[model samples]
Target: MFPLVMIASLVALGLLVVYYVGGYLFQNRSLSDIPAASPWAALTRFWLVREARFGRRYLTVDDAHKTHGDFVRIQPNHVSIANVNAINAIYGHGNGFLKSDFYDAFVAVSRGLFSTRSRADHTRKRKIVAHTFSAKSVMQFEQYMHQNLNELLRQWDLICQKAPANSKFARFDCLPWFAYLTFDTIGDLAFGSPFGMLKNGQDTIEYMDYPGGPSKYMHAVDALSRRGEAFAVLGCLPFLKKIGHLLPDSFLRNGVRSGSQVAGIAIARVGERLASTATKGTERVDILTRLMEGKDVKGQPLGREELTAEALTQLIAGSDTTSNTLTGIFYWLLKSPGVLAKLQAEVDTVILSPTDEVAFQTVKNLPYLKACMNEGMRIHSTSALGLPRVVPIDGPAIEICGRTFEPGTVLSVPNYTIHRLESIWGADSDQYRPERWESLTDDQKKAFVPFGHGPRSCVGRNVAEMEVTLAMATLVRRYDFELYQERFETWEGFLRKGFCCEVGIRRRMT
Candidate 1:
């Protein structure tokens, strides 16, 4: 029995050695064959560790491109390419590259628009809700947005009026305000019910007595989604997946539960909208309404489950992204008095007056104001990190800055890094200079991509721009703002979400 056990152990040891040797050989061949850029050192084994530890892991991959040229190998299997031409080849229409499993962290129920891996699945899902955000649908919902903005302006005016005679005015956190506005706006559009955020001046949505408000729960979910990426890297080792769950029950489970609760709210809201369609008068025609009532290319109405998932995805994407952008822009405006004055001047000249109400279309046309907004977004990009995409099976070898990446490799181009590229935007790229935008030729403007570029760019771009334009125009018109606190530090976690800004606003006595 002892002899037999020894022989079995020897065989297992031999198998382990063969596996390690084969892995090393494969990695060596892959790294050696690639025509990588001069800067990329050929060290395959510790690439992931170096990227996670030494490198600016939190800075968007765009920084990597600026430092390492257009294509930089991040890990053995991962490369980040920031070339404009590659955007078309990779994410353009009919591009066969699938979203990498890195996005699996973003998925909730193994199905949903953002979570689904297949192109066909995405097409079908996108089709069902396409009309909801259509030009007409957005126009129809203008009243809802206008009402919310009006309320927000009213609150600001009251805050301005109530400022102490001697003491500085109440410093406001734009993050929460934008969060309130965005959640209320999306809530009204998606569920036909505003969370009354503007009414309450906060996110007061109730679900299981979760602390830190609904937005906090949302933030938790956003943070938890990145855990799967960590798991994937660690799980490459034996028994890691099984052991990972045993490490500790952190915010992940709470986040998943919160996400599920949010999804449940979306599902319930859809049902309520459908039930009240008869009496609701014209159905409001929000994205949720169109999604529930619209048909696919096959002329088939979306299934009930599909409708719920799509609606939930729209609410999350639409609300969170716009909120983050607004918060970032507002923080920047508060930080720079010069930029704020310029933006205020532009607003006053174009859209702001004692009797004139700021309209989205009019505000959007103000070039300086637009430049300020664009520059703010460029510097403090919400979607700082690049969306990961896997190379297609039979696609051409991706060549960037003289280096060719192999097919089936994962690549990303973080907007955070791209926006800061000195070569593209010149030396003031790191500085918040709206004038730089004014001086740029049309060709230069093409590189400013806060909403991303190409066919798969943000579907809600128009709505987001309009919302932000109106909000900023309104705030600038009524109040002269200053940063109450000097330095604002960012908490870098899952997304490049902004915080730590406390601004004091006073009513313009003109």
Candidate 2:
């Protein structure tokens, strides 16, 4: 009798879930007539979560767009939108949509620029730190950026110098070097000194130096990214973390640990800066320095939490985005020697050298170099996945294209898909042609958002562009590189994949 009662209760609970999920959740509340990618999406974000866990969300969403047209119901309350106009309504300044709760997963600290959801909080933070990213700041950061670039060139020069004469080529992977260079550069700009990555030719972030031999700090960052991928999925399911042994890069282990470790590094570096002030030396000139002294209009300085959060944001956002794009730029350029030669000609005409540290201002105005960067960014948008923003149901009704979304709806536009949309770009959208940039209309130009758009866009955009342009100009003018490794693949995750370009570089005979 006891067994019968238990079995009956279990059966009743299963039917209740089925009725609630299938009957109620599947019936579109206010997202009238928007076609779901599958019935599963209308019922729950189960399909989306599963795809994200495997790092295949973008590919899956992209396929859905192709099948279901521009808008696909990604969840019962979430819609993945991919059109040029959607960008303005969703991400443009003054839009009422707040960042969705999906962002809570990325807040390393309690608060920061990247993860802060409230528009008021974001704006307040943005105003206080805007000076750190000013044109004057970029000009000052140039010397520090070049110092790291010089080290990178020195390292590459050593490789070229030691290569066998018969081959006249050194097989080297530029990915880790790019990571190290960016880390060192951002370190100098944020911390008055670099983490010694370029100088040491190794991972500098201490937590990354785990038991399985040493690894790149960015690898831990990557693990954190993949960890977000797992959480974004497993979070939808309850008690999945209990089976921690089954999940290698599960939420509790790698992601949280890596994120917490990176945050500690940021906080510790801040502690170091605070301690250095009493020394006989003048004040350290870096973003963090500016941030510390900066006061809001209300005469309040940034609190310790704000300071640490912003500094970590700079290190992570500034380093990864630039390195990935630089890697992408090199990947595209080497694969297309004709484009490389054209860019080389454009940059070489400026009287730069392989051995000389190229200034950001010198290459800032170069047309083809700018074109190459833009083209590379388009091909591999750093923020390729959808930047999700929740619609305000309490405000006016939101209608994207012909579809109307109710309040509390989640809207995301993927630049990865939009970048290659045949309508916005030409028929050759899939190709890596830099010249395509020259003929783009103003509206077409607005559609390019590698760093994102409006107030919420990347604050370090200028610094990133400066670093990439200078590095690209310097590298192209100095060496002619050929892709050495036949097997090159992008590491796919919630953020980006592991796309590294291993190239055989030889000094130009000039």
Best by lDDT: 2
- Find the number of clashing residue pairs for candidate 1: 2
Model 1 has an lDDT value of 0.64
TM-score per prediction, in order, is 0.82, 0.89
lDDT of residue 106 for candidate 2? 61
Candidate 2 local lDDT, 20-55, one digit each (tens): 476435555666477887777777656666777666
Task: List clash counts for every candidate, in order.
Answer: 2, 4
Off-target runs (Cα >4 Å) in candidate 2 are 1-27, 207-252, 278-282, 485-488
lDDT of 2: 0.76
Off by over 4 Å in 1: 1-28, 32-56, 60-67, 207-253, 278-282, 352-355, 441-443
RMSD of each: 5.5, 4.2
Q: Where's the lowest-lDDT run of ten residues in candidate 1? A: 208-217
